[model samples]
Target: MIGQGCLEQDDLSSSINIMECPNVISINMSASTSPISVSWEEPTAMTTDGKRIAIFNQSHSPGTSFPVNSNTIVTYVFDDISVCSFNIVINVKQVISSPDACECEPNFTFLNCPLNITSDQPAFCGTVPVNWTEPTVIDGCGGSSSVEKTHEPGSEFPAGVTTVTYTFTDSFGNQSICEFDVIVPVVAVEDDSVPPVVSNCPAHIYEVLEPSQTSLIITWDPPTARDDSGLPVSLHQTHSPGDQFTAGGYELVQYTFTDAAGNEAVCEFAVTVYPNGVNIDTQPPTVPPTVYCPAVSYTPPIITVYVENEATSADYNFTWPTGATDNDGVTPTVIASHQEGIQSFPIGFHRTAIFYYDTSGNRKDCYQNILVRRQGSAPTPATVINCPQNVYLEIPEGTSTRVCWEEPVVTDDAGNPIAATLWQRRLHSGAEFFINGNCNEQFVGNTFYDYYGNVIRCGFSVTIRAIGHENLPGQWTQWYNRDRPGGNCDCDTTPSTACSNGEEPIDVQCETLAGDDWLTVGLIPSAPEKRGQVAYCCPRIGFYCWNRWNALYGQQCLDYRVRFKCPLQ
Candidate 1:
């Protein structure tokens, strides 16, 4: 209005009469619903041409209440808007309308993310093995995704606890993880049981009747052992120190048997024998009778008896009479005695005085009669009693002394027979020393003058005059010296040499020792005195054998008898 009409600058010239048009309509885009199409109805009569006109403008805030662009207007076809936002204003003769509204919500779709894992698996016991399966995506979501698998206890899972994991990835690059468990089991086993046994003995073992028959030999084979079935067992043999069972002669022996299970048993055996029959006898050994003189009253000597293994069961005994005489009228006498059991006669001389034997086989005996004789009554002087050379005293001057002859023996020269006067005497020393006093058989001192006191010497001669009248008296015989005088003391005075101290060198040291030294030395170098003698009688008499003696003296003289009688010479 101000530009098209002629304008005059006048204030208030009737207010120019201009009425304001009504507000224009608008198309709005709501923030809650974006990317939408906006539309509105047209405004009224503001452009008088009466032609329908459409004007679009971006809205600037026309009022203080709404936010819009002031100078923008947009025009487009019905389908021209896409993904855009705006507040639009319309002017068509003052009215405009918004297009059909269209809104696009944010494009929406979900993507699934499965899980996956990677780790080692578990192990098993002993030699047991294991199986494993990888984890898989069991659950799924909206969008497509990839799943990856792995084992917790890797490759080999033992007979024990184990686990596996699965991981999934979505197209949106999201991921998830899951797991499962696995289990395993195992087991074991074994065996044992048994016993032992034995077998039969050997046939070689048996009894025997031999020299060593009292004992029996035994032999055997080793035994066998087995399980409850039958296996060989062990055997061992043992014996005692004196055990006779071994090949040698021992008293006892032992053997051992053992089983496979180490058990044991023992066995043993023995032997013995007895004795048999026998006999024995005993008798006195027989002794013989003996005679002394054959020409005179003769008699047999007595005898003795003996035995072995006899009825006495030992050396036999003889019950002899104390005064037993021989068949020859001779007295019996004991010589010697002894005892024998086994080798009685065989071991020594047979018992000449008896007989003997025992339960066993044994025996012995002897011979019988012997001869003896008696002396004659009358006897001639057989010998001169004193020495032919007379003896003298140490004194001289011819001291008076008696000279006499004795007839101690009264037997005949041959010891067989004699006359009534069996003894006689002779006077030879009477001429040397005169007889002063005389006894019936012996004369006293002889009378002689003594001129000097020194030793003297003398001798005399004698003759035998046989005076037997009967019994074949022998012719007169000359006298012979019987005994000589002189030596008296003759004995051994010696000692033994033995030392009690066990000392050495006995000859010197032992003799020099005190105490019994002298006696010991005497015994060391001297020998005992031994003496013996013999006697003979008439050969006509059975007693011609010699009668010996250890020592014979004047005190032990004896007489003999002649065998036949003879007239006086």
Candidate 2:
């Protein structure tokens, strides 16, 4: 038996085959109250004799085994003795927790929401009240009583644009906002009122000579009126005030008044200018018996004068005949129908008639005859036969010089002697005088007064003439020098020698004499000095003397040295 056992052992040992150990196995099971059943296929092995398989825990502890189809712990090791080992493992997967299902939908909505409103209304002169509708909000959760809104309904809004906001909030805090605009447009308004009330029309009557007759000044107070809207009233007239109307009968005028509302009212009045019965006297007065003459200096014989009647019943007016002269210097008078005061006639034979007129335009005239003898030959101009030479006299201030000179002989064309009636002298100082047939007269000495001082020289000339004789008019003789002898001449009585070449030289000299104390100083070489005098000088040499040396003597004298000598007075 031992030998047979040994041969089997050698055959098992030589036939021993190590199979691949089964991989680690896992078993899955749900979490439960009971233990899990673990299961795995066992690994096969080859040996000379029958092999045995055993299972143990990983610690190799004895008695730690697991049944193939029993509920137990799966972590175990299986081994074929002297061949290979296998492992088994169990994995537990618990059930996954899931969230609870939700089915809630929260939202917001706008309920009875106000829409944009546009309004067109007439413009109010004053402030206008505003109105609007409020917006309501509806939430999907419930009612929208908790919604917030801005600009409440029926609130006053200005005439322009306005905005309204509505905000809705749901129970879940979701929000919905709605907005709209309200516009109030402006519109024009019309006004209709009655026309203005006009009154105060006038009726005028005027006479011929009045301004209303010629330029008919048709004037009346401006019409007074009222307007419903308190607007100003405008007035217009067919003819303005101060407008002239022609001489005529009755006339009509109109005035129109208007108000701001375009209403008008008109008023009418009448004007009249009376016709003038008195006619204008257009016919001029009549004159008869005109005269003629060949010479301008011949005297004529005077004749009686009278006026003839030409008007019947009208009042009469008579005027003396113009252009009539008398050699005796007597003025003629004209009465109702007679003329008197006839003595001598003018050189020319002038026959003039009296002019007569009546209120009714009738006229008549009277006649006069004046016959003048015509001379056979023309008269000759007067000649200066024995005129004195230019004389120089130094009359003192407040003194005078006897202006002595030989009278010039004069004759007519017929060799008849002519009488000298008048003599004229024009001084270098622009003073002129007419001496009545006197060649020897007292010449009062004077001084030139100017703006600067008293420094002027003067000279004069003399001429003769036959008065009332046109043919015997005298000619101017040579000029003579006027000297202030011994500085003696009555300064107060002497005329001023202020010379000017302009109008009325003598008058200007007299006017400048004011405030002059007979010794008012003046500029040297005055206007008279510039005009070349013959040794002439101012008589007085005092505090106001311009040139110290007297031009008459060519020597200077002190105030004490100057003497006053009256030669002619």
Candidate 3:
């Protein structure tokens, strides 16, 4: 054999000792390449069993790197002329996976929180599908995939109120939850024919703007609508509260509300703003408030004067304005064609025209119709008393008597004499009347005065009579008086008038129509009040002789009130 040919088994063909390999070795790879050392037991050959080999050789020794895919190790041994060699296999540990650290922190905030959503139910009653934006969350330690949510986007939801909750956890197991509602109506609404009811709708709004202001900011409660059906409603307006309004004629603001069933209701109002020193007097004035006469009695021609500077309290309800006002902060000049208190207005209607004028000659005309009414009650008829009864006088023979009495007095309920005018209206305020059928010598019944006129009757009576004296004997004497009362009395002294049926004449004899029977005994020249006038056939009838007296200046007698002397029957 040559010097390196000792590994060849040509001479040791007969002693064939198999070369054994070391068991497969395994080593893990590290950050750096670290070698692993391997060893193997030498096999015995025909030459000296386990004796030391004359030549030992190995492909890799200790301190040799054995990495993955590189695990072969061979060893060769030769004892004298016999030798054996084998290979060793090594396995390096591979990294299948790596463990991460635990993270838990409650100190996390949500970048976005979901808001409550409202949606109408489907026309056909059923569950409705709803969608919402996902909430954004920020946590230093975690983000599993997205955020933890109870319901996903575009999820089916039953009608009625439903709460959706979102939960979050941090590295240290700290958990927090954010929730919102997914409201959906369970019952579908019917087709609505009626409109929504609007409330708090404003009337025409009027405001005065300052001279320096170009626009006025008007604030009012927004109109609200209630759906006839129990469903939600939406409102849209042309203007909102606190919006600016310029001065023109009328700036109309309209509001529309729509219900779930596609029914709509509208509310509209005008905002009229006028600049200073300008007036918007368009309509006619209404009827003024009713006024009453304060007099206790019915008095005609009441005069009421309205003071120019007097300010009446204007707590009226949109009727005729109590007084005029100016937007320029000045008392306006008032021009009224109708007189308030000066004119004698009956308890009825009176028309008035009012004009409001500024210093700049800007005028606004208005008309008001006033009404007058009576107040209190009318006084009752006046009370009259102290009327004399029927008078009877028995004067001595051939004498007259004076008839005098207290007049009737008038008084009120309080015993106080009422005004003369009041007495005139009810009591006998006119002249006293004496009613006799014809012109004759007689004292009529009494004094009678009508109430305010002769037409109405109201009076007391006064009567006077005389007694005749007996001249000789067999003459029971009594005075007979027929003052303007016609027919014949037989001069018989009786309390009542005794009329002689046709069998008696007037007074002298109850036989013929001519003689002393019709001749009256005495005459009262003046008012028949003087006593001791000439009686007992002394002269003639001093008043209206009427061809019966036959003497000088007898026919010149005026009206006569005669009483005759008669014999007691």
Put down candidate 2 lDDT per residue, 349-416, tens digits, no spaces. Answer: 23444534332222243554433322232244332333233343333333322234333334444545
Candidate 1 lDDT, 153-227, residue by residue in tens: 335543333445455554433333333444332111011012222234222122333454443444444333222
User: Model 3's lDDT to the true fold?
Assistant: 0.41
Worst 10 residues of 2 by lDDT: 502-511
Off by over 4 Å in 1: 1-300, 303-354, 358-369, 374-551, 555-569
lDDT of each: 0.25, 0.34, 0.41
Task: Give the better candidate number (1 or 3) by lDDT.
Answer: 3
By TM-score, who's the top model here? 3
Q: Write the per-residue lDDT of candidate 3 for residues 348-369, one digit (tens) a residue.
A: 3234456555543344555554
lDDT of 2 at 541: 19
Q: Model 1, 558: alpha-carbon shift in Å?
A: 21
